[model samples]
Target: MNEHDLRHLEIPLPFAPQRHSMSDRAQERVQIWAMRFGLLADDAAARRFESLGYARFSAYWCPTASFADMLLVAEWITLFFVFDDLQNQAITTGRLEDYDRLRHTALQVVYERGVTGPVPPVIAALSNLCTRTFPRNSVAWQRRFELNLELWLIGHARENSFRQAGRSPGPAEYPRLRRDASTVLPTVDLAEVIEHTELPDALYFGPSYQEIIATTADIMCLTNDLHSLAVEYDAEDTINMVTTLRDHRGMNLSEAVAEVRRLIDVRIADSQAAAQSITAEMDALHLPPRIRNGVRRCIRDCQSAMAGMELWDRTETVRFTPDEELGATRAIDYNNGFLDASELGRAAPADSRRV
Candidate 1:
């Protein structure tokens, strides 16, 4: 595969709906999970981001439940950044709101009923396990991404979208914009969320984890929608997650599911065609080879996990009277794991071994 395709695999083409940055707390959750996995010990990383108020305020966040997928999700997030820079544009608010709503609804449904993707086809509660388990760097990296997400909205919104690309107005304008953002997301306004995270002291990533997190997160979100083809079909009379849960668009679940599968097939083809794009970026940017390897591992792991959780299996379906499964909301009797994440441990390696 060439560099373009490699980059495409690392990143992705933005779809109709939009994507958002992982919150700082969500990043912290990852750190927490790593701690359990013996990933890291001290709070040095966390302390750096803590200073950036934006990183601290919202915390690192995700819409999936599977921790293993966070690697893909992070990649996906990074891809958006790439697109954002390339297009000389940020993301849109309509898309951000769409994903945000999906995240909130997923959290609630998972909490109350334990249903997973029923919230939104593209969204789920799987990543929460990662967030609840690990957390982002306190202020450094988390703050930058958090603001990037907000700025993305600034360019994409109807009223606030900026005509040109450049730095935001300034800190002075933040207070008022915060009030306006409150209108849409009362508690988590655009400015407020941007300002909440703590700033990083010095850019302090060890060898390389960026590609790992970004690539993994991207793969998970994309694949989830693909795997749920039947459930997402609007004409198949199956359960359509996005229509029913987020926008309340009446769609046939079975039909939507088939369509989603077809969509994924095409995405794979596109990735194949664009493999050179990745190597091109790497060569130009000169990212470390180890970072590329980490990215590869993430992709491989996600590929395996997706294959393992193949939703095609009958057992994965939601029965009208679905067999009793633990509801997401059901109280956890965390005997040993209530505090220590190590007890629950990370998901068994789900991705396939790379050829």
Candidate 2:
């Protein structure tokens, strides 16, 4: 996509509510599940969860879900963050071998249940999620989700290898790795489970439909990289879109941030176009009314994901703030919203949270 010369850019917001009404229920579920998974094993762990705002983060994914489904989805999101926090610690501590072992153990728990041994909290959480969420799902859906999770881990390992060798990925290579590493696909996959409707294989695997999901992932990844750029930079992490662009394209930080914003807008436009095209194809296709409705619902869920997540990124979480102190609360300047050119900076200030 060509970078447009523009004075200001507005990131799209979800027309629907950013969160479900059962905020209290969602919060309680996260707490109970965190305890069950041993994520709140100590004061330090409890403090970290409090700082991350897991409940706030969970509310953003599906705004209209039933309380039961919302609880499942929130716990699922918790599983991701807990796993992510553990991996970040592993990487920060230079425990690459331990990280590898953790990956192996988690995957085994996901794919080969009933393995006898003590399971860690992360894996325990994952195992519980798999049983609760996937029992009635299609084998194909299960496999797709499994592959997405596996690829995410693989991407992290690949990025770690580059760090170990003191190398930076070129602009092209970075997106390829980031797509999987970002774990957007599996996140989007939840639209099916929470909505309780599956897109049939023919529609799901169609070119236009796949494009819609990929563009959704692309949009999410760009927004995330931009949001987290400052934090990653502060940590001296090189495996990020901003850093990759600066190193590979020889641009300064401002140039990279601008380019990434342009890319996010471009992906948003592309996903809209793809959604329209897929809808037309669905209308033209002669299918059972139920199946047709399922496809339509699936499409709507994809759109909801974009809006929900955009709202969450801008308003809910402290994961991308400039301050290292995670416990402090921050206010969101929606007027100075995400993708606004005027708000562009190395990172959101300690006072302002941005997507």
Point to the candidate with the largest TM-score.
2
Where is the poorest 10-residue window by lDDT in model 1? 330-339
Per-residue CA lDDT of model 1 for 218-251, tens digit only, reads 3333443333333223222112222222223333
Error of 1 at 180 (Å): 21
Tell me each candidate's TM-score: 0.31, 0.82
User: What's the TM for model 1?
Assistant: 0.31
Q: Name the regions of candidate 2 deviating beyond 4 angstroms.
A: 1-17, 113-116, 283-285, 324-355
lDDT of each: 0.30, 0.65
- For 245-304, candidate 2 gives per-residue lDDT tens digits of 878889876788788878877777777778778766666665567766666665666566
Count of steric clashes across candidates, in order: 100, 0
Predicted candidate 1: what Cα RMSD to the true structure? 19.0
Instruction: Kindly give the stretch of ten consecutive residues in candidate 2 with the minimal lDDT sum.
Output: 346-355
> What's the distance in Å from true for residue 72, model 1?
16
